[model samples]
Target: MTTRDALQTQLEQGIAALGLHLPADAVPRLLDYQALLERWNAAYNLTAVRDPAEMVTRHLLDSLAILPYVQGRTLADLGTGPGLPGIVLAIAAPGREILLVDSNGKKVRFLREAIRALKLDGVRAVQSRVEDVEGQYDCVTARAFASLADMLGWGGHLLAPDGIWLAMKGKRPDDELAGIPAGFGLRGTHELAVPGLSAERHLLVLGHA
Candidate 1:
C-alpha cells in the first residue's frame, strides 16, 4: 500500500477509537488536506511534522481528540498556524461557523488555500493579531499557541460572555492555571489520549466565572 493509504487507515482507526463518527467523505477530505499541507510545507514550511504517518497521529488525531469538548455554534481558532485543530474541526463539524485567525501572512495564505481547496463552507480565514481580532464567538481554541494566561489575555475579548475556551497543551499546566486572569475560571482539565500518540496531552476547558 502507498504511504497515503497507510496514513488514511491509521486516521480511520484513530477516529474509531475515539468513539466518534464522521461523514463518509470526512476521512478522504482530511487526507486531502494533509496532502495539501505536505505540498505547501515543501515551500512554506508550515509545520515541522514532515512525515505523513506522523502527521496522522500528531496533527490530525491530536486535533480531533478534543472534538467532544467543542461546544456552541461559532468558534475562533486563535493563532491557528497552518490551521491545526481549526481546519480539522471545520471539516469534522459541519454547519458551525469557524474562523481561523493568524497574523503570519504566509500561514494565512496557506489557510485560505486549504479552505478553498477543501470546499469547506461556513469557514473563513483572517489575517490579524489575536488581540486585534473583532467579533465574539461561542467557542475559542488555541493549540500550544501561548500560555493560558496570555492566550486569555489577548483573545479573551473575542469569546462571548458565556463562551468556552479549549486550550490544547502538552502537559498539565498547573502554573499557567494559577496565573489565569480574574473573571475567567478553570472549568475542567481533561487528559486526552490521542490514539497512536503516547505524549502527554491535556485539554484545558475554561469559561467565565
Candidate 2:
C-alpha cells in the first residue's frame, strides 16, 4: 500500500475511535483537498505538509477533530490559511455554510481553487482581513491566526452575540486566555488527541458572557 493509503487507514481508525460516522463518500473529497493543497503548496506556499499521508493527520483529521463542538448557524474562518478547518468542516458537515477569509491573495486564490476543485457548494472563499470583515457569522474559528487576546479583539466582531469562538491551539492556552479582556467567558475547554498525531492539542470554546 502507498503511504497515502496507510495514512487514510489511520485516519479512518481515528474517526471510528471518535464514534463519528464519516460517510464513505467524504473520503475522496478529503483526498482531493490534500492533492489540491500539495499542488498549491508547490507554487503558493499554501501549507507545509506535502505528503498526502501527513496531510490526513496534520491537516484533515486535526481540523475535523473539533467538528462535534462547533456551534453556529454559519461559520467564518479567520486568517484561513489554505482553508484548514473551514474547508475541512464544510466537507465533513454538509448543509452548513462556511466563509473562509484570508488577507493573502495567493492563499485566497488557492482557497477558491480548492473550493471549486472539491465541488463544495457550502463554502465561500473571501480575501479580507479579519479585522475588516463586515458581516457576522454564527461562529468564528481561527487556527494559528493570532494570540487569543488579539483574536478576540479582531475576530470577535465577526461572531454573532450568541455565537461561540472555536480556537484551536497547542498546549494549554491558559496564559493566553489570561490576557483576554473581560466579558468573554470560557464555555468549555477540551483536549483532543488527533489520531496519528502525538502532539498536544486543545480546543477552546468561548462565548460572550
Q: Give the best candidate by TM-score.
A: 1
**Lowest lDDT 10-residue stretch of candidate 1:** 1-10
Candidate 1: which stretches are off by over 4 Å? Answer: none
38-118: candidate 1 lDDT, tens digit per residue = 999999999999999899899999999999999999999999999989999988888899999999999999999999999
| Deviation from native of the Cα of residue 116 in model 1, angstroms | 0.5
The reply for model 2, stretches above 4 Å from the true place, is none
Q: Looking at candidate 2, what is the lDDT of residue 161?
A: 88
Across residues 92-142, which tens digit of lDDT does each residue of candidate 2 receive? 887778999999999999898888888888889889878888888888898
Which residue pairs overlap in candidate 1's backbone? none
Assess the local accuracy of residue 55 in candidate 2 as a C-alpha lDDT between 0 and 100: 84
